[model samples]
Target: MKRVLVADDASFMRQMIRDIIEPEGYEVVGEASDGVEVVEKFQELNPDVVMMDIVMPKRSGIDAVKSIVEKFPGSKVVMCSALGQEALVMEAIQAGAKDFIVKPFKPDSVVSTLGKVLEKDD
Candidate 1:
């Protein structure tokens, strides 16, 4: 099973993603409530995928993405974004995120996008 690290400042969002992603044959190895935690948890969990939020506290998701990508060149990060954040979304993609998902997430979109992104190198 694929292990994912879920990161979001919103507790509810984290739970929601966990509830959906875990039962769908993916293992949610760890969670992070902020960008700083993202770095810490990532070092500990070393998850296969990281669902990251852009506007996190302590560190923005963009910076986190850049940092993680620099440290772990093969890491896959999919930014979790809200509607109307086009610029940031593009920035994230440029920063080396494999892809992104809009907020008010749907299970199908999440699963499909992740599948495509994760399978790219395979």
Candidate 2:
């Protein structure tokens, strides 16, 4: 089972992701809101995968990704973004995010994309 760190400002979104992924055998090692918490938790939890939201307070996802990827080169991060944030999403990938998931998430897309990201990392 892979450990995942879920980073989103919205409590509901975090819970929703936990609900979807945990049942599929992924352990949510940590949950965080905002960019600073994401970075802090990433260091503390050291999860295999990170489900990160792009638009966040304190540092923003792009900024956090850049710093996190630099420090944890082996980290596999998949960004979560609302629809129409294509530019930011591309920036996230450039910042070393393995992939991304759009908002209003579907269970299949979440599981499938996570699989692809983790597979590539492996």
Which one wins on lDDT?
Answer: 2
Error of 2 at 58 (Å): 0.5
Candidate 1 lDDT by residue in tens digits, 1-122: 99999999999999999888777888989999999999889988999899999999999999999999898898999999999999999999999899999989999999888888889893
Model 2, 60-95: lDDT tens digits are 999989989999997899999999999999999999
Q: What does the lDDT read for residue 16 in candidate 2?
A: 97
Runs of candidate 2 exceeding 4 Å displacement: none
Candidate 1 RMSD to the correct structure: 1.0
Clashing pairs in 2: none
Each prediction's TM-score versus the true structure: 0.97, 0.97
lDDT of 2 at 74: 72
